[model samples]
Target: MEARTKNVLEPLAFLFQLITGILLFVFVIYHLYVTHLAEHDALSYEKVVERLANPSFKVAYFVFLAVVSFHAFNGLRAIILDTDFGARNKRAVDVLCFALFVIATAYGSLLLISF
Candidate 1:
């Protein structure tokens, strides 16, 4: 059962990484387009702020933040595991990464709600 669970979670984690990476890439492209609008005087700073103020956008931003944070931390964890430090303390590093992910997600959600 433990082995089965690990197998399931491993793929799920990889899927999350893949999805979040794609999402971040898309966001970067969209952000660049928005920035381009500034060059044409079509994108005002106030307009950006107002768009973010929309409740739906706020929620989507929060979700994006959470996913990106988790993906980044997981990537770091993977890198650490590829090094000597992780060889000696894999479990500890994993726990730290998980804690960071939770804290980031909670803080992002709080900020979204407050905004």
Candidate 2:
């Protein structure tokens, strides 16, 4: 509630958003290049599976998913905090954001690992 407390958190939020935004940009380009440009042939399920079969590719995919989930959830939190109601419910909103981020990251990790 105190302005000093808010100031301490402000820099953290800004720093995280900045890092995630840069990561998301890099991931998007990687996705585009790998999913499209790298594969000239019509994408087949077999080809996809073959690509995902590599250990390195699997790791990269998981990183992409994790980064994407974090970036998206953080963006949502920022949007929510822009509203008057959200500004008042900071604790609840922060919890909700973390919960969603964890759940989504878990689901994505499972899928990537399974593949």
Candidate 3:
């Protein structure tokens, strides 16, 4: 890739990772807080399920899952590239990573929709 393209893509990828990470963190915290309600006898497990079944919450969860999966898969690819593995088999590794990302994303989407 050209230097200009690299410059643009790098920042975009970084931004994506940052945003996804923050969202995932927020989701985790929210999940914990909601679960904690049970401890106080203020919320039941069924209530949690009902809340998740809400259309808005379901959409948010699906989006969160997508973003997190993308961020994580790309991060793994970057890590591999940073090491000798990518140097030895750059083309093969890149192809493999692309395939894995597609497969994972599709499967995750299916699960999110079906569930």
Highest TM-score against the true fold, candidate: 2
The digit string of per-residue lDDT tens for model 1 on 25-100 reads: 9877766776585457536767767767788878767777887898999898889877999858877988999999
Predictions: Cα RMSD each = 3.0, 1.7, 3.2
Note the clash tally of each candidate.
Answer: 0, 0, 0
lDDT of 2 by residue, 27-103 (tens): 88988888889878627888888888899988988888888888888889889988998899987888899899999
- Could you give candidate 3's per-residue lDDT for residues 1-115 as a string of tens digits? 6568757866886797798888889987866776674456426667656766678867777776777677777788778867897767756765787788778878877765664
Local lDDT at 17 for model 2:
86
> TM-score for each prediction?
0.73, 0.89, 0.70
The C-alpha lDDT values of all candidates are 0.80, 0.85, 0.73
- Scored against the true structure, residue 106 in model 2 reaches a CA lDDT of 94
User: Candidate 1, residue 37: CA error in Å?
Assistant: 2.6
Q: Compared to the true structure, candidate 2 yields what TM-score?
A: 0.89
Candidate 1, residue 50: CA error in Å?
1.7
- State candidate 3's TM-score: 0.70
